[model samples]
Target: MSRIKQVFKGNSQAIFNIKEIAKICKIHRNTARRYLEILTLKGFLYETQKGTNRIFRLKTRDLRRDSI
Candidate 1:
């Protein structure tokens, strides 16, 4: 219904990796990555890079959705 909500639900997998985001969002890798980067920059999400993989989590612990 809302863009932020969509980003959290249809986009939560991105919280794991951009590859998952692309698959879930049904978009190109670059596009999905852009979404992750944008969200991280906006402070809605934050990323933790471990080796070659990145883990994304929400900045505000207060916000939790069924998808997350």
Candidate 2:
């Protein structure tokens, strides 16, 4: 999960789909999706639907905080 967070912290304003995150993190897509869902539930990320895809972005509140 920390690895996943690093991806978002690197580009706070960038939004990503599960596939992109999985590729970047070098994890299985399902694993990436689960981590994303956990972050979303924890209020660290925002999830939005783009057609059939679920996109995620770091929350602005999280960006202001040192700890995620």
Candidate 3:
């Protein structure tokens, strides 16, 4: 999850799909998706539907806080 947060911190404008997260985190796509989903549920991330893609971004509140 820190890896995902680091990716967001490095690129504030970046939006990640499961596949992209998988590639960046070096995990399976399914695992990436699950993690993202959990983060979303935990109020650390949010999901948006763009066409066929389920893209994710970190919640601004979470970004402003030192801990989530």
Candidate 4:
């Protein structure tokens, strides 16, 4: 999960879909999606729908406030 967070922190301006995040973190797509969902729920990330894909981006304000 920290690995996933690192990916977002490293590319704060970038938006990512599950597949890209999964590949970057070397985890399964399902795992990436699950982690992303948790982050969204925790207000660390913003989730948006781009057609069939669910895209995620770091919530910059929350990123500065939260450790994770």
Candidate of highest lDDT: 4
TM-score of each: 0.63, 0.85, 0.77, 0.86
Ranking by lDDT: 4, 2, 3, 1
RMSD vs true structure, all candidates: 4.9, 1.8, 2.2, 1.7
Residue-wise C-alpha lDDT for candidate 3, range 1-68, written one tens digit per residue: 77777777777667889889889988888888787888788787788775568998767743666664
Worst lDDT window (10 residues) for model 2? 59-68
Instruction: Judge candidate 4 at residue 26 and give its lDDT.
Output: 98
* Ranked candidates, highest TM-score first: 4, 2, 3, 1
**Model 1 whole-model lDDT (C-alpha atoms):** 0.62
Please count the clashing residue pairs in each candidate, in the order shown: 0, 0, 0, 0
- Clashing residue pairs in candidate 1, if any? none
Per-model lDDT = 0.62, 0.84, 0.77, 0.85
Return the top candidate by TM-score. 4
Look at candidate 1 and tell me the lDDT of residue 30.
76
Candidate 1, position 66, lDDT: 48
The alpha-carbon root-mean-square deviation between model 1 and the true structure, to one decimal in Å, is 4.9
| lDDT at residue 32 of model 3 (Cα atoms) | 81
